[model samples]
Target chain A: MKKSNIKSKHIINHPLFLPLVCLLLVLIVNLIQTPSFFKITIQNGVLYGFIIDIINRSSGLIIMAVGMTLVVASSGGTDISVGAVSALAGAVCVAVLGTGESYRMPYIISLLLPLIAGMVCGAFNGFLVSYMRVQPMVATLILFTAGRGIAQLITGSFILYVKPVQFQYLGSFLPNVPIPTPCFVATFVILITWLTLKYTSLNMFIQSVGINPKASHLVGLNSKMITFFTYVFCSVCAAGAGLISVSRTASIDANNVGLNVELDAILAVAIGGNSLSGGKFSLFGSVIGAITIQALTTTLYAMHVSADQLPLYKAIVVIIIVALQSPEPKRWYYMIKSGISSGRSAREAN
Target chain B: MRIFKKTAAVILAIMMFMSLAGCGNNKAPVSNDSSDTGTDEKSKSIYVGFVQVGAESDWRMANTKSMQETFTEAKGYKFEMVDAQQKTDKQITAIRDFIQKDVDYIVLAPNTEAGWDTVLGEAKAAGIPVIIVDRMIQTNDNSLFTAWVGSNFKQEGYDAVTALENVLKSKGIPDTQEINIVTLQGTMGSSAQIGRTDGFAEKMAAHKNWKMLDKQSGDFTQEKGQEVMESFLKSYPDIDVVISENDNMSFGAVKAIKAAGKTCGPKGDITIVSFDAVHAAFEAMIAGDIDVDVECNPLHGPRVEKLIKALEAGESVDKIAYVDEDVFYAKDAASIIGKRAY
Candidate 1:
């Protein structure tokens, strides 16, 4: 068959198309509501207004969601501890680098160490889940509940105000531009991860475990090794997110940094048409989904909705998206298949 | 399969039984002592039931300590402090349990103003004086409690605004220029949120140039405060001022500002101002990270002692007792930070 012949089938088979459909629907509605919404303008040599700001601000979620998608797809597991992991990593980096009177740390070490710490924590989680045979949820739950406490205990609870000029430049934007550094770092990581998955046997093994761990183990695949690496990778991703987060803030307090980010990343992955039950993954879709969620919030804020009402709106949007993306009812789905099959048979007889 | 099923069922049942037993053991059994002699002639020590809002932050811990330290047996009161862990239903249950035990007076720092009138009314009908401390409740009836011993929250907000205005004036910033202010409000519908926000809004009205660019509830946590402040910085590029309802929240905002590569406090890109005279806030101010502090005066220990004394003497005290406070800056509180209890 020609490549064009397969292109039509690809649309129906692909999971990532669902979020694209939703995104289009939202864009169409916005276009109808506000005629000027689709327009963009440059101000003071920088892109301005609600949509741009939303995309820039949601870089952290986009990066984390990409990592979460892989972890979920590979091991049928979720990392609810990423937020705390990020905080702990940020705190560790700051604590090691900071002096009580003034903060001073070399630029490269401050940026690299937190991610390293986060990977170690993630590896710890992986070790328990893969080797110790603990449930992923249970293994990560300890970190989710107590990681921030540990972070605070390590950092002494006060916000570490670091003044290293070189380190401060990591999360800073270009002169007179609104483009955040996290956005660039997240985009680079996403590209690297995408390339790595495409070029490696790790991708196939990860998919195998996700499809059925029993089958992978029977085939002599190193299921535990794959599972362990998946979590470690996820932690590294979260560490990157945290580094950007703390850099964006120029200070780190273990108690409050990166709190509830797990929820945002999970929501982003879900909105990107990834399954909570696990199997398939989409990094690009998750990035768009993250921006979409942030955009919706920014739009709501611009519309003057009360702060209390924002959560309600977020819940409603999530519910609607999840419901629409959910697999069709079994009976209705079978009915449609049977109807199409019968029609095809009739055409063959003709 | 049947044997495995049975084993799982047995284990689950045993776990449930153990948890039930654990909960039963965890609760401290109330002891009733009716045998004490000689003290009965001179008004039995008033049993005080203090249902705290939990140690949510340093301020809450200070508030709890104040109640406990003041309402002691030596001060003619028996204090039973129940930690509610910041849960409303739990606090309500604790209050009901206190009422069942028939305490002389009930002190409550409610999680929120709603769902309180009924409980406070119940305490009132039981003839138990309910002292509202550190925070306020929503009630139309003033007779529900004897007195409210707390700082003038609205005044704290006014004081913050006053300090901000004076600093701006001293810096030679034009009073006519519209100053972009972002506020990290406490828990929504909380007494602190209401009083502090309203006070600042009212005072800033006189200075039409001072405009609130964004106001979001931080839920009184350092994390949410920082997160919201990050969004505020993104939303409003030139947010010149950050006003937090408490020290913890202001500290969170300071982090967000610094992360955004903006300066904090005097001569910085963004000025950090907040309520609560906690040691951390003082330290931040001394370090030039914070510009102003509106004193919330968390040392209500002496006031709690005075209230208990009046109750023991059978003397009717004022309906409300205001805690005296003053606004402080880095220079003003240089020597006093060490003396601060909380």
Candidate 2:
């Protein structure tokens, strides 16, 4: 349907339309509430304000959602272990770096090990889902529960600090740079993913496997392999996110590092109108959706929404965005449009 | 095949009966031994079985350490601890295990506020005095436990107000100065959040000139705390003071404040008051990032020790007791940073 040459007149009702509108609506609400919400000022050569925060804070989620989109598309199932994997990855990063106010190992090893740890975790899930024929949810549930426990074992049930100026650069800001470092990390990951999809046959293979695994296998596509690759890649992406978070805080707290982040990543995928059942996906939509989620959170803090009532207000906005994306509202819009057109023709004939 | 199945069932029944008899025999010897030792106080060690919620963070580790160090062979106490690993079912099982062993006392740091009545009742029936620690379990019967010893979150909050006053006096701000304050709270509806917020609010009511600009929950994580602080900075530009519920949040707030080209601490633009005087908070204070820290003490071991001694002497102790806490200024941080147990 997306490839079809449908008339441009229906662009208003396109799949991507409501999500962009939802994002705009949230930002617009922010603008109306606080006129200075969009204002950006330079502090110590870095851009400072709520807008910078929205971009910086959502970078981790955006990276995870991109990986999740492919994972969901390949296996036709969601990976709920991304959050826990990130926590374990963070623990590995800090454990290698040591809790002392210095790096215990070379900086490069600390970075690579977490990604490798994440790959192993993802491979475990991939093996279960693709080879053992287990459901993705059940496969990932093993890591979802045990990952934090493993992390705690590494950190000795403590929030160990890495406290060095250079360590904070990736998560916060680089020396004399105007933008947050996470923005670059996230973009680098997204760009690599986009290039892989565009230049390689991975995009087609994953989508084919997701749409129909047996048919894709019969058609000479390594469907199971594609599914496994997606899980591994997704876990690697989660590890990247873990690195970003660890750098941002310069510390590792297994219990709190990626707490409830899987729900956010899945929610971002849903908000982007990506089917959790798999087949088609939009990375851009998920990115925008992540930004929108961050925007809503910032808006609540800016509005000083009562602490207990914060979730209630956030739920209301989310429900409206989701309702707009649903079929019934668009069905009503098209029904009213055709009714008006017929009435106009009948009046002209009279 | 039917005859084989019957034989298997008979074997299983015998195994089950043997396990039940083994449990009965274990209980008998434990009770008899405890009774035998009660008459010879000088020769026997007082056994204390602690059912602890797992070490989820640095604070919990310190808490477990405090208890382990305080109750030892030198102190004539035999301490046995079961880490619940943040699960209530495990805690209940550990408590029951302690009961079967007939320990003189059972110390429980509950994971949740509910679902401990039956286990506590079992301990009560076994005549073991249960000392509740850290978080309180909700039970209607006050007689279920001997005494509850934990941190007074409200006192920490009240003490923060007093600490802030000292900070203000030193900064030369007048008592009647129109001070603007904001709070980065912990998770909403949590005991810490509710107690600290209420404690601070109750005391703030006495100061007419101090204005609370906003209060938001940061969920007690540095990342969320930073994001919320950024938002708070954007909304209220001329904020004077910040009350972060925990040290992690305070660090995040300090980062946000610094990124916004603002300063904090004793000589900075904003005076930051934080709770949970962790070692990191001491480091932060010494660095002039945080002005003062009010301790939510995790050293319940000494308090529990005192209670045990009182109960041993047949003296009635308070139904609820609060562990001692301290308020440390940045000036004190330099001298006291080395002594922090956590």
Candidate 3:
């Protein structure tokens, strides 16, 4: 019994525990509101249900949050330009595909072209933040404003539409496919990133640089190089997300494709128990965090919440969850618990 | 690193100069040669400066195309076109530029309803006729512009609801039968959202059996529309109709309905009513996925041109000129889908 208690305690104290609890709490609330929340049915050989929809819709944010975790861990600042960069990447890909002229370019070339454009954009941001020594937020703000404009310019200020069957599979389910393609894509990315970090010392180098850049530099770590790579990797992730989004709609709107998604990515990082100041991070935690947000949105919609009041409800719940994870509230809760236990022990002695 | 910095700065400088040169090139033909041409055909050709609100969507693109096609130099009009890129201040600057150029008329499509009073006062003082197109401005002074020409958005909403009612009636749903509806609104607080929501609700109130199951903003995007419709499917399984504020949202709703293993359209379980009779909406209608589409015509070019001619001829124009539009059912959509400009 004692051993079991200790194991349970250890699980509770784990870094991913809070986000899991928050997600569970939301799920339970939803189940209470509608008992069928967890029910999954297969339709036309594909999973058709609310839970599947949440997972599928969250794939873009999950990919974005993975890259964001690395950047936050390395540089101690957030990239506000991920949304715009995603727009630019999608625009580049769609422009090359050339609206109903998809036969002009091979599918692979269309896909690879956007990823390359995203790398260049990421490299520019990395150079500004690493070499020029500019603040990450300010450096990213340049692209945050101009990136969408650049995308508009690429498509000549028109929403580019493509009708490629191969590309549609990225966003939709194929014949007899039981899962959404984006879910598989997101999982593949997460697994690859996890395996790479496990086998290589890149994770250690990033954490050390994030913890103390000057000390890491003195110890022969190329901090600038690490920071630059992280930004580039983050941009690649954003590009992947952009491709999924454009595929979902089969069209690209420069103004609204990845609109305000950076905020959600940052929020996911924070909700995953990672400090905005940078240091130790969790990629899995961020994934769970992204899912939690999508679940919350799904729950709100199921509850028949008005669209205008959604932001207000979201803000209230987010504040409560974040405060529960903060240091001050935890400290207060521990103090109160110890005080009550000590008083009970004294009463027993008397 | 130093060499890289120098090269980057040079590249940026060159880019800046090129953009400035592009802007200068656009302005040169309008101003430098205008005086020469104005002297040659002073009375025959009337110079008109048109300020557009940018091509943000296909509708806006069609609107711009209409203006370009109708107001050409070959048609005896010297047209100076300026795209404001959805910024009110840019539109103001274009108006001021037009005033300085001494153009006979200025056609303004204001991006917002606020902040136009001051610049419009300047246009009025300069004695240049300004015809407001597409959107209205909030000016206490009535004479800030010559006329306002656009669609009555409220009427468009009423037409959409009427079309939906007709579909429901044909499906054997009596007026006394309780009808469940879910509304997918546009961006909240937008003029379209406010007008359409109010108009539909007002008409719906007259039907005692009509009930609004849920109303939420889809932000006029397909992705949001799909997500919202998915949730609505979970919340209200008995939804009889979906009133989408635009065609894009209806497209999304149709996808969601299909994904949920449910049929949509007048012949199906749910009837979808939408605004903005874009080509895609007509295609959906013909496919029997959407039941009704009320036209919110974006092509105001010919109407604005006609008004401009009237003003030049010293004829008085109406205070508010509304363009005529029609409501389309699935049967009628097949006939007109090819001729849709937007």
Candidate 4:
């Protein structure tokens, strides 16, 4: 009895277990409906199939979610300006790359410039929220409103098309390689983030600050610095996502690039079974959540659902998933299990 | 606390400076352009206030360029233009400012179709004849504006379907043969998406053999277009034609098709039909990557100019003026692409 209780507790407490189960259920549904859903074929030494597409597409969201998870865990408030900041970063990168006719800068410099721009933008948000003591939502709202406009200004309100083969490799598959470059980039980001959290006290400090800033401060922790650093980290992740997106399309439209992507990042965090109100967090859960969301989109498209009704279908599925993950359902589930077990024990006793 | 306050103050100062710098740049171009035409020409110039829906796309940029080129002091017009930056409230405010300036004529390209009745009524009351361009306004009053110059979005959709039908016939495919088509729609609920989707659906319904395999909104962006098309390819591997609502999405579709190891073009296994005969669309047609392009001409500047000229001469103008456009096929693309402005 003790062993079974420990095993059940381990299953329930596993950070990635719930999302993995949800992803599996989706895959199972797809498999039953379309047997070839899991089939992956190699085309030109690169993987080609529905599953590959989901991984490739979810890379940006996964990277964004990782940073977002940190921010949410530290501040207990979400940043809504990530999408706009991403556009700004992409525009800056493309501007530095310049048009084909006039190569203004080297490729590496062009790439670094955008990432730096993202850091500066992130730093600005951090200053507003941490230093000025402004509400995170309101502080980030300024960037949310002005970020795309700033991006548009950088590009002269025109789509900057990058023609170099080197830039294309960031978004697309490299020569003779089967997997997309973004998948590798995302893996690197996740691994680094996971390792850093594991080795350092940053995660604990962030969680402590989020749970109660005054108490953390009383405990001699630099709670303000911790929160500020999380915002900076989130912005860098968003910049990485921006780079991968622009590389994929080889063009940047300030208005459309990274539009409404912040919602996806936030949703991924929620679906990953992390609390939006702050406290304990899981990077792995968010990654799986991002993959699940992308898989859901892919599954709907494979079913030939009309474009007009796509959002409605997505909303319904998301509602069900969120409901299942909520505390109310979990309590009811445990209650039912306990009741059934007690009734069986009573029957045995009699 | 002191250090935090100092840092916040520095950042706020930088933000303020940047905003001021942006404003300075916008005003510099108008002043320089007007001054370049010589001060003598401004004496008899007809002052026209033009409120534009901001430069969001290449098509919009081209449209704005055409207007700036035509409405110059040298051409007997003093143009004062405001970029609304895709905000309805901004456009209304600009219009109100123009009315206060008492310009000879007010030209507006509304960002949306609603909430213009009150401001437009003000312009009408001030005796400033407003020339609505590009998009239509939702006003119950018929005399709210002088005239509207734009394309019929529904007709553009019908024309796209008609062009596709002609292409199918030329390929020796009988009307009775079953044809599977997928569509990459624009932003949902927007006027373009609604009209284009509805018009095409109406036309496609008349044909018994034309079956719509799937339809998905790309939100009129290349990235979303490519992503949606990638999924479409996996589901409907045997699709014969792709109806992209705009050229941008069509470009994305081409990339997805190639990545999927499928051929897409006029001569390839799949035929691609796209709307908006922008320069890139023509180039795509010439390259045989696009089979047909329905022209939703962005060059409404010249047409609006003509109507304004007629109104200033004390002559009556039509309530609505439809700009003439042509459909392009691969064979004719090469010849027509050079002369195409947008």
Top of the candidates by lDDT: 2
List runs of model 1 lying over 4 Å from the truth. Answer: A1-15, A21-56, A102-139, A155-170, A173-179, A302-304, A323-350, B1-55, B64-132, B135-147, B158-182, B202-214, B218-243, B247-273, B277-291, B329-342
Model 4: docking quality category: medium
**Model 2 per-residue lDDT tens digits across residues A250-271:** 8888988889899888888889
Evaluated at residue A151, the lDDT of candidate 3 is 83
- Compute fnat per model: 0.09, 0.66, 0.45, 0.62
Model 3, B1-342: lDDT tens digits are: 577557556645653554455345334222213445444564778788888887677888888888777788788888777877677787888899889878888988889888888898999999998888888989899998889888888988788778877898788988888889999999998888888998999888888888999999899988789889988887777999999999888988987888777899977999999998887788788889999899888778788888888887889989898877889899888888887777
Candidate 4 residue spans exceeding 4 A from truth: A101-104, B1-20, B27-47, B69-79, B97-104, B169-177, B309-317
Model 1 pairs whose backbones collide? A248-B259, A249-B258, A249-B259, A250-B259, A256-B223
TM-score of 4: 0.91
Q: What is candidate 1's local distance difference test score?
A: 0.75
| DockQ ranking, high to low | 4, 3, 2, 1
Give lDDT tens digits, candidate 2, residues B1-342.
Answer: 366335435543553453455335323211112333353653488888898887677788889889988987788887778877678998898888878767889999989999888889888988999999999989998899999999889888899899998899999999877999999999998889998999999998999999999999999999789888888988898999999999999999998898788899998989999999999999999999999999988999999999999999999999899999999999989999899899
Query: lDDT per residue, candidate 4, B303-338, as tens digits?
Result: 988998898798999999988777899879999988
Worst 10 residues of 3 chain B by lDDT: B25-34
Candidate 3 on A1-350: residue-level lDDT in tens? 76996797698779999999988988999888978878788865678778998999999999999999999999999988999989988898888887773556877887899998788778778878887889999988977887887787777777666766566678777656889999999999999999998899998999999999889999999998888889989989999999988887777878888899999999999999899888789898899889989999988887778888998999988998888789897688669877997998899999
Best by DockQ: 4
Please tell me how candidate 1 rates in CAPRI terms.
incorrect
* TM-score for each predicted model, relative to the true structure: 0.73, 0.92, 0.92, 0.91
